[model samples]
Target: MKMAGKMDEEIDLGLAEELGVEYEPYKMSDDEVIEALRQINKEVPWEIPVSKELLPYLRPTILCEAHHPEIREEALRIVEGAETSIDAAMMIFYYMISRIKYAMEPPKTSPDALRTRKGNCFTKAGLQIALLRSVGIPGRYSFDKTLLKVIKIVVPREIFEKMPGKFTIHQSADAYHIERRKWIQCDTTFDEGLMPFPYNWNGKTDLLLLCPWWRLGHVGKSPYFPVNELLGRFKQRGFTKDFCAREIDPFTEHLRTLSIQELCKHYKRTLGRRDADSFAHILYFHFVGHFRDVHYNPLFRYDTNLEDLSDLQESGLRIFEPKYSVEKFEEWSVSGIPFEVE
Candidate 1:
């Protein structure tokens, strides 16, 4: 007899064959996918009712908690109040990106996500979908591979020799199908400023590396090893808890051996070291580049004609224009996610 709960193992193979890939792509026909997911849910070993397992992975923690009714209400209110197409689109996008914190951290527990105001891209996308759907707007989530290209004027040839590939970041964009217009792409995570395009770097090429940013639960098994494992590796690298919080390390081996004692020592030492600030600045810059590589590189090209808020205003929709600057635009920190004009 086939072992109980073995259907999941077989489902993977079946899905792979259907998609013609090595792994399931998370794109499934609506009904078929739902039924297959139900079967997979039944196979889970957790004591929590399998029905609860169907909840979206990135849903807001406040929604899950008993006391935080305001979050859901506020989200619904914003959606209900949207008057024009632009307002609805902007409000949804703004709410999605602002609620989630940007971090390199792995998936969070439901409680943790509820307590903290930040999360990785996956969580942000999921929450956006849920909030949109809750308000009766038709929203679906999907992932695509994005190529990030960075152009530097005078980098050493040695750097190119060391690494060369299109850096790929997995991003999630949502679409709303209005009666007149077919589906249009609305990016929720980063500011939708002028969508960056591949042509922006024309004639100047320095380096390209494609790192995979797998959308959570969409791609095959995650490459994200646990934090504890990373802590252990940090110790091996001569970095101790005194250097940083064990929980903050993203590399698996370092997280594994991280200890509170080491952290205390590192914290104390970091207090007086003037270099600490500089070190942090350098680290932030490096991580920012990595984040850009994974999140912003493969940019969506928007209509250049729709460049200014005046266009929307001329179209008779209320538009909120925040102060704009070149630095902010370059960093993709344009306006907060767009929402319906209030």
Candidate 2:
């Protein structure tokens, strides 16, 4: 797959040239890119038709490096036994989420996220898109304005306090399902351990409910990775690594005080019944069963030595909180009036 001519200035110039595609190092300004995204959002149909038009979605970009040898090889392994595009897409989505643990301040690119095995919504979406595209499945990044209530639930109060009252950029991914002949949206932000039992995607309908937030609107879709947009919007408003490190202990402590019943209600109201019950179990395991930290799920992180209750208490809870912070947000950024919606 070749990088689209329009995207030449946006992608890695050296890589594009190495692949025998036309190349330019600097083409579009950040402003130009943003305007182009606005146009792309306006022009592209949500139900993207299957055609050569999807070529851009499949091509490698700086952020979504589908052409990377490692990414391509991993994608092949993940979908080795898949019989159809839908199955491959599903396998890729699950594999991406399973590899990357959900966290507040994640890596910006797919390769970094894959290396660290930790990321937030945007990074997860980016990695998933890269993986899908690596296997010849056309994929794109999605952007949206979503409520802070979803974030407030997972993070510590101190971090949440610095955040906007509502409406921050929420990201997800879309993979073109060959059988359905359309793009299927999948929010693989939360991994299996953090998710409920019944949550799934069939590659026909949107799998957006995996997240705890309701979508508000921003750049609804993009043919390429939207990581730069996320950085531009959130960077000035972001907190420092020191701030996140100081807040990690408080966040970890606060997890213990979280009311199971209240969490269940929140999950049920936002995510659905299955998530509610599953989250409750996770909390139950931590608090009552004496698991060290609710966040440390061995399945995703590859942590072999889970300390026993007595050993855990002595060593202290070790939550792998991301050191950086993207928590800064302002209400006025999204709407002139403060967001009052629950």
The best candidate by lDDT is: 2
Model 2 regions more than 4 Å off: 1-51, 210-213, 240-342
Most accurate candidate by TM-score:
2
Residue pairs clashing in model 2 are: none
Q: Candidate 2: lDDT of 154? A: 58
Backbone clash pairs in model 2 (N, Cα, C under 3 Å; residues 3+ apart or in different chains), count: 0
lDDT of 1 by residue, 274-332 (tens): 32233223323332343344322222233233234354345432223322222222222
* Segments in model 1 whose C-alpha atoms lie over 4 Å from true places: 1-71, 84-86, 109-115, 147-169, 179-181, 191-342
Q: Hey, what RMSD does candidate 1 come out at?
A: 17.1
lDDT of 2 by residue, 1-342 (tens): 121222423544343333222322323343443443344333322322234566667666656666666776777788876767777887776676566667666235566667767667776887898887766677887766666656665576566777755667677888888656788888787765444222345455666642333556445577665434444444444533334436553553344343333333444655455444443333223222222335322232222344433333333322232221111011111111222223
